[model samples]
Target: MRTIIGWAVLLLATAWVGAVEIKRPVDMGFVPLRAVSYEEAVELCTPLLSKDGKLTYAKIKNLLVIHDYPENIEAVKKLLAQIDEDPVNVRVDIFMDQAAQEKSSSFDVNLRNVRVEHRDGHTRVDGGIGISAGQGSREMSGSTNPFIMAGNGRPARIWVGETVADPVWVYEYGMGQGWWKQELVNRDLGVSLWVLPRVLPNDLVEIEVYPRVTARGSTPLSVDVKELGTKVVVQNGATMPLGGLDSSRRDAYRRILGVGSVFNGSNLSISVRPTIMRMPERLRQEKARQDQPPEKH
Candidate 1:
């Protein structure tokens, strides 16, 4: 009986150790936004935006200052205008605690504090814009399969140099799916393709591309067939469609397709980019070469 009791104690101790080992450093709420001089705020938040007007993932360790002195409003506006022109390097400071940060792991931006300081009196506002991280997982579930269908009876082949303006269906996991109307579908050869309904990390998804065509003689047609391909896995909010392409590929693909790209992620943020019409064939060849069995060198 003593031995059995000892074993139980040992088991409990082991479980406790395991639990403690798995405990990660709690994410403290984001650094708060404090009132600061115009120069100070600009200097602090500039690093948050990249050169392309996109927010960077780097955590802001400094307080954000907005000179809200009524006299300084125009100056603040001018400073904000400059930051807007180069938004990639600009970020608004919002206060967050460790729990809130963890709860919003997929969010790109957070807003918690809004204080407006004026010479007459200081006022703390309660609202601001918050941008969350894009969804990284794409799974299809429901009675109806989410797929793009062609219009005509004939098998539609969306070839290079073709443009398709149709409602693109986005398959969101957990949330009821919705459709984006007039999505420009471009089938440029060797160009990058961006699909909606964001994917999550380590998620494997199958993407289907379809072309619309009209049947001859005005006969009504069923939805066209779809072409299937493996979609690239997402690292953060963004991903490259073709394997082996870097983050820059997103812009490159847009340029090659001449169609706008919009990606909606888990955070409910929709990112839109203008159309591009071509992708480098050289990159595709390089990928194919790497995928092939190593040759005797």
Candidate 2:
């Protein structure tokens, strides 16, 4: 009977030592970029200190408090491997929530164990675990068509416009009297035009424009155009020259007519327009409501 009692005490003491608990809070300074799951924490620290391995309790507490869990699992694993291989001068400890452990626990699987060891002039730690949840996926579809045109001599112009559910308009012409017109070809991507005459040679021509944009329940439509080769912003009410022309009137004329004696050239233009059909107010209101965050229950 005495022997049995002694054995029982010994077993209880062993269990108590093995079951030592560690609890500590982690601080991810203001605005944490990522949150780690519990399973990741376990995978990262398991090798440094096993279920029954020797470890400093304070070190374990520190690990739990500073580690960012699975979010930083990869980094934690690398650090562990380094410490393990150099245990002579390195130490590591980790603790995870019970819920995370339960979630990570699996049956009939070859559980990967963390490794720690010290080698010639170096320490190494290896292995990592991760946990993920609340993942989602989405897909979107759209298209765009951009076009360019050049001129050889005569004053040339091109006009292009688009008519879609919501359209935008853009075009380019000489800085002089004529304006180019662009026809909307595809309702989806907008329009394109290339006009070239057989004769006349001149400087390069350029134009840039944008379609008017308006939200479903918004007021008047607004347009924004980015200047070609420059950071200039041009709006609907602004008049922008297709390309800066030379100051000399004769030079400008020569540039417009193509430098060669008998000038001939081409012009390019483009435009985007929208064809919006107003929807029912009720439907619009419903859509707006759906876009808003749900109220607390």
Please give the lDDT score at residue 148 for candidate 1.
21
Candidate 2: deviation at residue 218, Å?
A: 27
Model 2 C-alpha lDDT per residue in residues 1-297, reported as the tens digit of each score: 999999999999987876653223332211111122234445655564433332221232223322333334445446544533201110101010111111132334232577989999798878765544443433322222332222221122323444445443556666686565655433322222222222211311222221222122334343333212211222322333333322232222332222332222212221222111234678756654543422435
Candidate 2's C-alpha runs over 4 A off are 21-297
Summarize candidate 1's per-residue lDDT along 49-144 as a digit string, tens digits.
Answer: 323222112224232332223324344345544643110111111111111111223657777666665555755566687886664543421111
Off by more than 4 A, model 1: 24-56, 59-297
Candidate 2 yields a Cα-based lDDT of 0.32
Error of 1 at 4 (Å): 0.6
Evaluate all candidate structures by whole-model CA lDDT and list the values in order: 0.33, 0.32
For candidate 1, give the lDDT.
0.33
